[model samples]
Target: MPLAVWFVAVVAVSFALAYLNSSGWFWIGAGAVVLLAGLGSGAFPMDLFLVLSAIFALCSVVLGVSPLRRLLVSRSLLAWYRGQLPAMSQTEQEAIDAGTVWWDGDLFSGRPDWGKLLAVPRPKLTPEEQSFLDGETEQLCAMVNDWETTQVYQDLPPHAWQFIKDKGFLGMIIPKKYGGKEFSATLHSQVIQKLGTRCSAATVHVMVPNSLGPAELLLHYGTEEQKNYYLPRLAKGLEIPCFGLTNPHAGSDAAAIPDFGIVCKGMWEGREVLGMRVTWEKRYITLGPISTLLGLAFRLHDPDHLLGSREDIGITCALVRTDTPGVNIGRRHNPLNAVFQNGPNWGKDVFMPLDWIIGGPKMAGQGWRMLMECLAAGRSISLPSSGTGYAKLAARATGAYARVRSQFKTPIGKFEGIEEA
Candidate 1:
């Protein structure tokens, strides 16, 4: 390129970098423009340009051949950009709060403790657990003959639902003492993974209750009386549970949910008691249509300071029966043709006793933290397992197809591109 063209190119790059709000890139471009201008004005020899070109080429080679590119891009450049950016969203902050930071150091210099990583316990299923998984696997495969054809209907067949309940698939995460299988996290993931390979819809049906459902919340936070009343029923599949967390206004910002409850006297079980009158509108609730019980989260308010001096007690979680008066359920949403019973549920003036709180009155105002903690574990196990199952299924089917499918009188698998895939 001519000297004038080089000068214009450098000036254009500087403006582009400034437009992108990249201060670092703008400075680099400005430095290059100054060098080019000096060379064009005959202030620097042609040999100087040759020397600079060689230096740039050597730097490029070093960056391409070593880990220096990633070190600069990810660790240095990206880290600096992140520092200048706005604070992370509440969901991201909560996830970080829920997570553990074991070691702290730079990426390149950090030494991970291999012993600690290897010592992490693996999940083992007992004889009964293994037998249950095998039986359920066979049962699911038989019921879900063709997942594509099954999607023609609105939902899973009645027999399929009955089979799931009868097999105790909904209560896998609950404790054995509570009449549940209480399978380990590893076993729970494995069961979901295996089921997902056969039918994605069936996996959701079985995975929901074992994941972020009332069974988990009640087990972790329910009072003894609450446990006695609900655990056995949940274990026996007498109750199908769904949690109400995501609302139309609050997709991921659980802390900012507008659905609320007011402290007041309310009728419960045909008697008056100091309870909450909750008003909520939630969408994207999994199993909202068929769930017999709804695990609801809402901000608790006390206009008259009924609970205490504090007017607002932050976010609270409660268990509301779907049959409760003023509660509207049964709205369905179809996402990606998955047969999961997901939809919106709303209530005008739903009333429940104060004891209906998951951990009872004492656990009020702790719902956000509780939900985050549960999510930390669920996020690590359930979805990742299902995703892995799908990947494995895709790999198997693709490999088989590549082996048999012909292209140019030869198996497609023989192609370099096909082999790379």
Candidate 2:
């Protein structure tokens, strides 16, 4: 990383290229002159020689940046690098053929497409970390290609869901002790990118658990005992989780409401209990209809009254069993362009022991902050993956179609007007 070492590496590469071409000898000679002059100047100066070397190195970098940016947008450049494409071995091809539809044909072929132009690279992971991504990619391909249209909503095959759980992907960012991969933010980004290319629904499903779920909240504030209890279940997929933040009537304004859910202190069945009874309607709750565990948020009531004082009526989040006494999950709703069964969850007088509150009693009145923390790292990730994948789809389909679909006695891709646009 030092300047001298960097300069040597750059000059060596340049000389190697020069040796390949007979005319490159002249440029090599010029470089040698610059090096000798720089060395001679070094003896007579304080910092002048080092400063000139730095300027030349920086100028070389700036000169390279533009060509690299253009190469990313060039179809011809990708074609030139066709030899670098990892060949689909017979076993890999058979794996695709035996898998689902998304992995078939050009879908998983890593075909060059124009959509790469729109994608902003998030970050790169180490080669070792990126090696884990192919499994995620193949699994995602099967999920996307295998969506079956049922009498009701479209269903992701059970095998696909199981594949996700088995890959150590269900809890990507959870602690290693909890059965998660515990990868860095960069690794998570790569996994998301690979999954994104195959299916948006699968990407969402994979990310929600890793991003805004109890895994993160537990990591942030749960006691060691609490983590030991829940993190493993979540990581293993024994307990499917859903967040309960947005309420139907309240929508995004739930924090401003009163008398949303009731809380009281008492003994339940001889156990000292701080319990809550929630009565609210929440909709568009991702994974809500199918989740086994629900992470609920509500405004608390006073011990003496249903609607407590503002200070006493604090906002709280709880980890509740979706199968708890008064809870009801509705049919799947399809509001988005692509849908995988999401809908409303209603709780009428649902009660749970106070320990169900995340972080126990110590985290009281911090529901909003906790929710924000849960959502912070996940906001740009999920949507960008979806958008990038869709962009790639558009680009690949469009470019290939243009090449093959002809008009006016030529391929559409060759039309001057189209190219002008």
Candidate 3:
């Protein structure tokens, strides 16, 4: 072959080997061997081959060295491309810190631990949970269908709401000691899946409290007094809870929230106490309009360094009654024609005792981490269960329709395309 053809062949072969094996050292070695063969055959000048060999030898040395190899692999072209984007938000960073990468070893490492994956126990429902799911959940579905067709109210009717509360659907994840059903995660997902298939509105209503409510936050981080006061009310449906995390400007970037609370002395219930004056403008808060209790996230400011030496104590989570003096709620947003109560809520100079912070005063600056941990669990369980419910509904409806509707004097489902679908 001509020298130019041989050069092209060598370059192609070197690249192919490197791409296949993910090793640049292989590319250098292959290129050197091809160049040496060409020089031996007098297909290339000795001086040119000598210069090429020197360059290839240097590249091989760099690729072979541990430190240089690590630098090259870590600062990859993909990494450089991703670096142009914004940094991970506080919520994302906290999620990483919260140990979100539980099963990702299978993705990075060539060998996967099949035994560990197989060892995870499948969740089973208790007898009481099974009864509630078979009986009360089915009854609730009928009621939801009636309400949806009648269009009697935009939100769930008062009777339906009361029935859900009475059945303990809102507190599925709360402990039995706290007056809740305390269903297992698997049972909770099952209930949500059933509810989602019937009424997405009702599913959202039930999921908020079960997944990311004051009950969850309080259970994990609330003080003894806080848990005692709130958990039962939450379990019994005496109080409706809404989480206020998304701000008008912040959206998913919870760390960028501009809502703030400044530490100060305040008057509460005709007595003086140490507290924070909170001002927040939040939107897209689920159940905001009808919620009786608010789980608020804000940037805490301690100018006097009362909480710590730092001026900003990062994000903090607190509970504020919807009926609190400065709170402004009741506005609702219509999302996708769904009757779920989601909307904007704001407060001006809302003041509460320092103990109102979830997990008490000691957890004042630890809200971001708390939210991240709760969200990691919530995101994995709730949304996927709901999505599975939707897929189930679609499959059943499509299968029924395909069987009943005929084409070419035969059922459409008999066709290969429809059967595959």
Off by over 4 Å in 2: 1-124, 146-153, 257-259, 266-272, 303-311
Candidate 3, residues 133-237: lDDT per residue as tens digits? 899999898788525633767778778888999999888888889899988888888888998777778888888888876888898889999988899999999
Tell me which residue pairs clash in candidate 1.
none
TM-score for all models, in order of appearance: 0.74, 0.65, 0.83
Misplaced by over 4 Å in model 3 are 2-7, 10-18, 21-32, 40-43, 67-95, 105-121, 126-128, 146-150, 398-421
Supply candidate 3's per-residue lDDT for 155.
76
Best candidate (score: TM-score): 3
Which candidate model has the greater TM-score, 1 or 3?
Answer: 3
Instruction: Go through the candidates in order and give each one's C-alpha lDDT.
Output: 0.80, 0.69, 0.84
Q: Model 2 TM-score?
A: 0.65
Which window of 10 residues has the lowest lDDT sum in candidate 2?
A: 95-104
lDDT of 2 by residue, 246-275 (tens): 765677553553425566665667776767
Candidate 1 per-residue lDDT, tens place, 182-247, comes to 888878888888877777777778888888888888878889999998988888889999899998
Which 10 successive residues of model 1 have the least lDDT summed?
Answer: 102-111
